[model samples]
Target: MTVADGTARLCAPAPGGGDLGLWQRVIDALRTADQWGSSDSTGTPEIWAHITEGQR
Candidate 1:
């Protein structure tokens, strides 16, 4: 997700279309300092990437 100028752009599709809920959850996770580095530890959000961010 791209958090810029106060807006978080999650999963961009060709540029604009993306999941708003996912972005919100990502923001929440980051804001809460929750475990967000791995799928196994990120809880039920099921949104963590298994690979490096650059790889994704």
Candidate 2:
């Protein structure tokens, strides 16, 4: 996924690592954005929790 301010990044599926790294980076960036930054790290945890816990 691409972020604003004309600064976009990439994440590739590394061999043997599955799809965790890219997902983490995207979530981390989301946690960094001033416009959408989370008050706590709980945001990523919550979202991932939903996906992981089958709540979504």
Candidate 3:
């Protein structure tokens, strides 16, 4: 999945939504947090990399 500008773009699943979906969900959350930015900085949602289970 790809998260950009606070919007989430999910990839088509192979069959049943598997680990990729789960990983995507986690990544989306992190991306959201990152988009929120640090309290000291202005909040501007930016494009972030896809997060996988291993990276967690």
What's model 3's lDDT at 21? 80
Tell me the lDDT of model 2 at 27: 67
Query: Among these predicted structures, which one has the highest lDDT?
Result: 3
Off by over 4 Å in 2: 1-18, 35-56
TM-score attained by model 2: 0.29
Q: Write the per-residue lDDT of candidate 3 for residues 17-46, one digit (tens) a residue.
A: 367886676556657442322221234423
Between candidates 2 and 3, the one scoring higher on TM-score is 2
Q: In candidate 2, which residue pairs clash?
A: none
Which candidate do you rate higher for lDDT, 2 or 3? 3
Worst 10 residues of 1 by lDDT: 47-56
Tens digits of per-residue lDDT for model 1 on 1-56?
Answer: 66655444333222124778766766565454323343324333334322233422
Residue pairs of candidate 1 with colliding backbone atoms: none
lDDT at residue 41 of model 3 (Cα atoms): 28
How do the residues 1-56 of candidate 2 rate in per-residue lDDT, one tens digit apiece?
44445544333322234578876876675565333322235432222111112222
